[model samples]
Target chain A: MPKPNRSFDKSLWVFHVNTGSCNGCDIEILAALTPRYDVERFGIKLVGSPRHADALLVTGPVSRDMVDKLKRFYEQVPDPKEVIVVGSCGISGGVFHESYDLAGPVDRIIPVDVYVPGCPPRPEAIIDGVVKAWMKLERLRGENR
Target chain B: MADEIIHFVEIIIGVFLVAVFGMIFGLLTKGIDRKLAAHMQWRVGPPVIQPFLDVKKLFCKENVVPRNAVAWLYNVAPIVCLTSVIAILLYIPMGSIPPILKGYGDVILILYLLTIPSLAMVAGGFASGSPFATVGAQREMVLMMSYEFPLATTIIALGWKISTLYPGEAAFSLTTFTKYPVWNIMGPFGIIGAIILLVVMILVTTGEITKVPFDIAEAETEIAEGVFVEYSGRNLGLFYLADAVKTVVMASLIVALFFPYNLSTYLGSSIHLPSIAWNAIDFLFYLLKLEIVIFFSMTFIRVSVARFKVDQVVKVYWGYLTLAALIALVLIALDILL
Candidate 1:
């Protein structure tokens, strides 16, 4: 992994991943990016390409079908990066925890730096999740020296 | 031989200076544009230095080369794009400073140079070997073709008007245009024509920079960032710098063609400032002019409207923009005959 720095904290381009999301957490992520919440003020832009991403905003319980795709997408994000798993589903599979089609929580598939535990976390909570990712990055920056 | 060597060294240093200036100013303008756009939307935008931070972060990230990509071409493309844009800047006179390589090239040369960066980008997209990039590169080529006519027409029309009036000088040179201001040699119809050309130039500039409404080739939501899909880290950083510098190139071209008159030209008599001081003043004024041009052509228009469809982009550039340019050309001809 490349060492983190101040610039990484200042501008975090995130790529959203929906591993069988129910559209609930994804909508909240969208809402957070809206003009009202405007995560852009913090320089948290949602990029289309995982290659350009500084963080992966993963949502939903990882299904059997998505497990491979999730790992591929995670590897695509360059170093000095973060993975913020949004919603309870991604952390513990939420209501889908007992479902037979599940591969399990997001962190079980790949490492997660932050988790926002809500059925569908609010925009404020999502923003907090991004902020927490920044702190983790800042700590890495400190450790780098 | 000694003086020639000295002059060569001086030109090299000046080129480096301009490249640095172009990069910094371009990023600064992009930051300001974002801030203005944010405010316009009734939201707080990122800090003015956000682009600088973004570029820095991009540089520090890991460079990812796709397994299927042609690595050599992918790496060279960004460098080619950045260098070509900087080359164009060397030929562009800014704020009473004649282009460093002035008499060697002309506006016609600039028109050609302007295409190289886009071409380099298309080349990179194709080299990346992604289906998305391939589609993006095709759209970019088509977009480039459609915009080229109006862009050429605007420059040629103005160049024709200038050449006809000033038969003795190096008529094709940007120095000639700056010396003999385009607006000054116009009657009512000619002024109208010049104004129309100015509008066309701005629209062409919008397309040239690949901002919204004309950014079909790189539509992020539609095609996963299009040409830049495979690019990341240092490669993406270089592209960002190229983009920022290209914005400066387009804005400066507009300023050169239409609004070349500087502060010191009129103020030289009354202000009694040192030549260096006056030069500084004129340069600042030129920067102000560039910002205003960029704000309208790139930022304001992009924020106010939605992105145009690929077909609409072709139609606007080829159909509407080209016709308007031709009408302006005819109007200028009428002015000349009268």
Candidate 2:
């Protein structure tokens, strides 16, 4: 495996995934991309396909139905990938905890490198989560080299 | 024998030079296009070197071929697309420099060569075996067939006009286009005809490059990147580069056909620069023209419109644009007879 170098850190094309969250976190994720927030200034783009993504921005708790599909999406992302859990639901199942439709938090299904804690995190918090994503990338670099 | 060997080596060198030029300028233009789009939307964009970073990062990532994919074809498709777009560049005159393969091909040959990249994408889409890719490929073929007619009419109408004026010359050649520009040697009616054809060509170019309104084939929201859904890492990177180069190719085609004037032609007599310096100046001017064409065709129009449906794309191209091209053709025909 090639070292996940500075270029990898600089250009992070993220795929946004919604397991079962309310539309709240999804809208915030979009807000981060709007002109006011403009995550693209930092080369953090929201792409449609996982194959073209370097990171996954996951919202919502892992529901029963989404567990298998979420796993497939995680696998589809090319390797040297990071997962950023964007809302409290994805990190701890939030309001959906122990519910019949739930499959637990995102961490159980895939390794999550960063977390933004909010019922539906602010766009600012999501941007911070992306910055925190680089710390995980740095740690990976240290482990590899 | 020695002279022939040397000539062959020069052609090889020129081909490499053209490829390098296309890749560098293509990426730069894409970055600029992105930045301009950001500003148009009132946002601060990524750095101009953003594309370079993306391509470098992509190369370092793992290449994933889906389980159902024809791995060989999936991999070969991007390579074919990139090389074919570069091959088309070899036939287009750059700045004051004539085409590398000047006599080997002409406008008619380039018209055929232009389809190759899209065709390669279609083949790759089918080979990927994804349902989305298949639908995208079908849309791409539909879009391809729709645009080719207006594109051909524009080229043929101009070529016919030139053939009449320059009797016995290679009217369909890019060299001929530069020398006997369609914008020149035309009366008021022909000029209007040429402008209409220019608009048609620009819109055709928009469809060809698959920007927003015409990007039904790669519609991100509708199809999850459609034909490229299965492609990852280096293969995606190649497609990215090919898209950038194709933008330059289409923009350059517009430049060569309609806006073929160089700055040095007017300034050289007064400035008294060396021949080499004049070539450099003309090259910069050509780049400016390319930027203008790309702005109007790719950036401005793309930012303004929402994506069209599959049928709307066909209707716009076949019903409206083809009609516009025919009107221009009739005007040019009238200019000749009058």
lDDT string for model 2 (B70-106, tens) is: 9899999999999999999999988898888889999
Error of 1 at B261 (Å): 1.1
The lDDT per prediction is: 0.93, 0.92
Q: List candidate 1 segments past 4 Å from native.
A: none
Q: Chain B TM-score per candidate, please.
A: 0.99, 0.99
Docking class of 1: high
| DockQ (0 to 1) for model 1 | 0.87
Per-residue lDDT for A1-145 in model 1, tens only? Answer: 7786688777999999999989999999999978999999999899989999999999989999999999999998989778999999999989998899999999889999999999899999999999999889878877878
Q: TM-score for each prediction?
A: 0.99, 0.99
lDDT of 2 by residue, A1-145 (tens): 5578798777999999999889899999999999999999999998988999999989999889999999999988888998999889998889988888888999999988999999888999999998999988899899998
